[model samples]
Target: MTSSLFYHVSGDGQPLVWLHGWGVNGSIFLPTVTQLSQYRSYCVDLPGFGDSQPQPGTIDDWAELLIAQLPANAIWLGWSLGGLVATRIAQRWPQKIRGLITIASSPCFMAQTTPPWPGIAATVLQQFTQQLEQDLQRTVERFMALQAMGSNSARDDIRHIKELVLSKPLPNATALAQGLEMLQQTDLRQELPHIALPWLRFWGKLDGLVPRRVSTLLPQTPQSQDIILPGASHAPFISHPEDFLHHLRDWLQTTNKGV
Candidate 1:
């Protein structure tokens, strides 16, 4: 109900909903959305990011909010935090999701009792949260830079992300704080089995945030597909736009007749 959850719907054909990573909004996928203009695309702002304001509920509730807005049985694509949200949507409402595409996202972003194959150490998240609490603005700047670690264009990517992040500005301190908490506490390993929709997982080899090895942690399903992008960072759509779009188009064509 909050206008803070802003979205830009473009293109024509079946909806391609994009969810962005933490600390950023749907704009992170702007390159993809622009290139894939032939397909109906909806880039959404997670609660607290972009124009979306903080809401009272868990991350599952945030998924529900997106589901509520989506056209019936729309195609869903999420990156990092967005991927986690998409997974939750599939679990909660399998019938409404036509397919799932996760970009540089995994079932578990942080290690748990079961231990995700390759995920950020719990200590890293804890330190980030601590620093963020201590200095939200500075922490966000550092996080933007961290997204492109180990990349040739790391500096440019960081600058671009910083510009994008600052353009909209964070909604409120409460939402930002709560969203960070959600990111740290969320673990969807147990819920992955409940997803019955066709699913696709993507990873960026150079992504320091969600390491490529995280791809191995995904639960094997009958209708699941996985792709790994070489020489790509956390934001592959930006780093490898052509390859990313090509693969995306091919997957859409093969899967649902580009429905």
Candidate 2:
């Protein structure tokens, strides 16, 4: 397997690959994945974050690298930026990726009114991109705060996410910059309707970023449905992990029955 990025495999059952949000590593899912004993989890650090040290590249570059390291027919689950990457992987290699799960993510992240879209304002991300060049810590801290904002346990969520970010090697400015660029320019809504594989869209009712409204606006796929978790924010798994797991297991069971 490729050793370019850091990854861990645990438990034993159907394979599950987890990709984390920007600014943090895959270990952020440890608390919840550890409880998903039914899945043979493969949690990996995306390039430029955690122990993974490689030049930051485009979304296609990311998908090719990650898919090469995992088994075929495995389920892919991504959060925020990671979700975008996973979606690309499923599109690029539909045979390898059997199912898709996205949390707090949107195909078109840049908000626009021309096509009637819901997403992040261009100015806010523009500011973050500018600030990333100056102070990586402050910029990431601010982004983290934005993520935890609007959650019922907003204060506690920020503190916990901070601890996770601090525990690993921070992603370089270039990585953060490139990630923001992807968030600003990428749009996959036009492609969602074409994918034939199963997809589950997870959302937070209180999310400040990637508003729950985006799911409704997404092009509906044949095997896709959106599950909005009440009282959860940007990080639904972090806010209510057990509830998250409950839904996941139930869905997996339902999916397997058809197989």
| RMSD of each predicted structure | 2.0, 1.6
- Per-residue lDDT for 29 in model 2? 85
List candidate 1 stretches off by more than 4 Å. 1-4, 113-116
Clashing residue pairs in all predictions, respectively, total 3, 0
Kindly list the per-residue Cα lDDT of model 2 for residues 1-259, writing each as its tens digit.
Answer: 4438788788888999999888888878888888988889988888888888665568887788888877888899999999999998888899887799999988888899997898898999999888888889888888888888888888998898888767888886777887888898888877877778888889999998888999888767668878999999999888878888889888888876766
- lDDT of each residue in 101-219, candidate 1, tens digit only: 99988766775554325678779878877887688878777777888887667778788777766778764667666666667778787778778777888788888888887666667
Q: Which candidate's TM-score is highest?
A: 2
Per-candidate TM vs. native? 0.92, 0.96
Q: Which residue pairs collide in model 1, if any?
A: 4-51, 4-52, 5-52
